[model samples]
Target: MSALGTPRPSPLPAPPPGAPTVSAPEPQEPRSRKWIVWLVLILVGGLVVWQAAVKPRMEAQAERASAVSAIKAAKVFAGTLARTVRVSGPTSSQEYTSITAPIMRGPEAGRELTLLYLVDSGKIVKKGELIAQIDAKTLEDHIDDIGDDIERAEADVRKRRAEQAIETENLTQTIRVAQAELDKAILEEKASETRTVIDRELLKLAVEEAQARLNQTKADVAHKLQAHKSELRILEITKERHVRHRDRHKTDLVKFKMYSPMDGLAVVQMTWRGGEYGVIRQGDNVTPGMLFLKVVNPAKMQVEGQVNQSESSLFRIGQKARIRLDAFPELNLAGKVHSIGALAAGGWRQSYYIRNVPVRITFTEVHNKVIPDLSAAADVTITEEENVKQLALAAVRREEGKDVVYVRKGDQFERREVKLGLSNNTHAAVLSGLEVGEEVALEKPAIQMAALR
Candidate 1:
């Protein structure tokens, strides 16, 4: 329809002289342009081949060669697939002990036995019972010696008295002779009769004899009295020394006896570590305060364990625990927690590394046969969550702040962070980030084989 008139084209003015004019380029030959476009495409194709094909294949080959090994890796993933945390720890006795009546014994130290009769092993002794008798024979011998000394002292006194008596008689005879001579002179002299002076020499000799005799007798008595008193002092000193020796002998004899300090159960002391069943013997050179055996109160008992601090989060006071005795694991003893340590048991230099405090778990209830100090393996159940969706434990890996897994969709693999609940060696409970019937990589020691096969 050419109903209305068509608009006509309008012509513009021409360019001025000496001014340059703008014009479009003329079309190139089709054959030449086609070759140019093909060459440019080839160059671009080569660059893409270098990046997408050759580079990736080279990297894959290098990775296959350079990759080291599978775990045995310390870092293991924690899958929320476990039902519980199971640990094995040794059982310990609450009342188990190496007891001895005398704890005070050592090398180059010993108790002396003069005659330790009746203090042998296996002797049941009562409190204040006489266990042995030390030789008090020395004291008896000293007493005998003192008796002899007394006899000798008495004989000396008798002999000295006899000598004094003999001297007294001799002095009396001399006095009588002097008196008779004086009497005779008196009868004859009488005033004019004093002319008896012609016999003065005889009278003088008689008087001198009497005086000498008396002086000799007196000196003999004084010497004998001094000797008797001195000997008595020696006897007194001997008596004191002997009494001390006797008392000491008695004390030593008392020490020779071993008795039960406490009355419950008696067990002999261990000669060495790991020795058992109470096999102490007589003539073992035991000393005073040496504990050869012990009696225990079995009613009270306890268990002890030392756990690594790294696993401390798995522990809490009052948590339920189970114990399996190495000697009796089939028993499956049940227990509850009573306490835990607030401080580490050992020092940095301590054998157990006191640097990390030991968490002590006690069996709140125990079987009677599960005696205190009875060594057993303990499992502390720190936490438990039930009725949760659980999966194979191998699928979980502990990541920076949470549990994670590699989730597979169709043929592509992607990372999925998961939230965990409870776990055991067999399975872990899935709390979130995963669904039922979804296939998750086991991520186990054998996981590498899935890719290889």
Candidate 2:
């Protein structure tokens, strides 16, 4: 219709040969262009995919990368570990004391008074250890015997005193006699003064006679007094000796009962036979120097532990120590090494003790629970640690001798090589190849999960 439009197909443009025609873009609304753009892109993409397999190559490369990263890791390291040393032993005492007494007289014998009270081996006594007592009846009998002897001695002394008094009276009488004679002689001599030289001979003869009588009396008195000197001295000494003997006997009797010398429990010094393991009774007899009982101080107590040669090396002087009594485990006690053993063990597996060089420790605090004879154990730790990586053991995977972790990157999981340090059943330590706060896959791969359970 246009060619004729009739008026001359006004020379329509000649058709071009085998040339692609592109349509002019028409002006469009925003809503209308969105669908047309999407359809054109879809068609182009379909043709490209048909010509080349894009998805297969992408998948192959991803699989190759995953295989490369799934290697296991192991490390050689110098490990320092905490070791414990165990030991067991009993305890002992440091000081001991003894008490003695002498028991006397009766069926118990003439020994000192060590009998009549409770005393024996293995028997404990209080501070005032009165193991035995003197028999009251026996002591009373002795008193009676001494009283009889004292009475006899007193009689003898009194007899000598009487004799001495008699001698003194005789001496006084002799002196009086001599004085009277001398006065008579003087009176006679004075009376002779009236006589003259012719009659002086007769008066002189009378005076001489009186003088001779006085002289004789004086001589008799002197001889009587001097003759008994030795006898008098003997009598005095005997009386003194008897009195002293009585006093000394009484004093000795008082010392017959003995008591504990120190403030502590007492044990029977003598056994039923012989040793520190017997009973002492009130009726048992003893000598002046015999042991009666023993005294032991309580209050001083300690804990003891035994260690083998191998374990002893870890235990050093000044190292920290801890103790927990089976009776009181709730109570934790601290202590320091006071000393270590000086000698080797004499028995197998520490069955015997040398006691010469046992390792010793002084407690920091006093615990009443540790008695005189108590056993205990100890542990010593030497290793210390600080911040380190840790993880749940279930999340880690290993292939060959290498360790691997699946880290989440974008939409897919990527395999990563990791360095592992140490592990226990529940936890594993990460040495390197990972950082804190990074996303990692905890959910197991399907094949790995099935085998793990």
Which parts of model 2 have CA positions greater than 4 angstroms off? 1-97, 102-114, 119-131, 134-140, 191-237, 259-263, 270-284, 301-453
Model 2 lDDT per residue over 1-453, tens place:
332122332343555888766555543345645687788899999979955797778776676456433422222222332334544454323445756554332333445553666555444456565655555556556656667766776776678668867987987787787677667666766776686865667656666776787677678766766756566566657656655555655665665556666665445544464545555655666665577665655433334665666556667777666655665668767655656767765755544644323666555666545544446655443332335665555567787778877765544466777887655544566688777655555554445434433
Please give each candidate's TM-score.
0.45, 0.42
Error of 1 at 166 (Å): 16
Model 1 C-alpha RMSD vs. true structure (Å) is 20.8
**After superposition, candidate 1 runs with Cα above 4 Å error:** 1-109, 112-234, 251-257, 261-263, 272-279, 307-319, 336-354, 358-360, 368-374, 381-392, 398-417, 422-429, 433-453
Model 1 CA lDDT for position 68 = 19
Whole-model Cα lDDT of every candidate shown, in order: 0.54, 0.58
lDDT of predicted model 1:
0.54
| Global fold similarity of model 2 (TM-score) | 0.42
Worst 10 residues of 1 by lDDT: 67-76
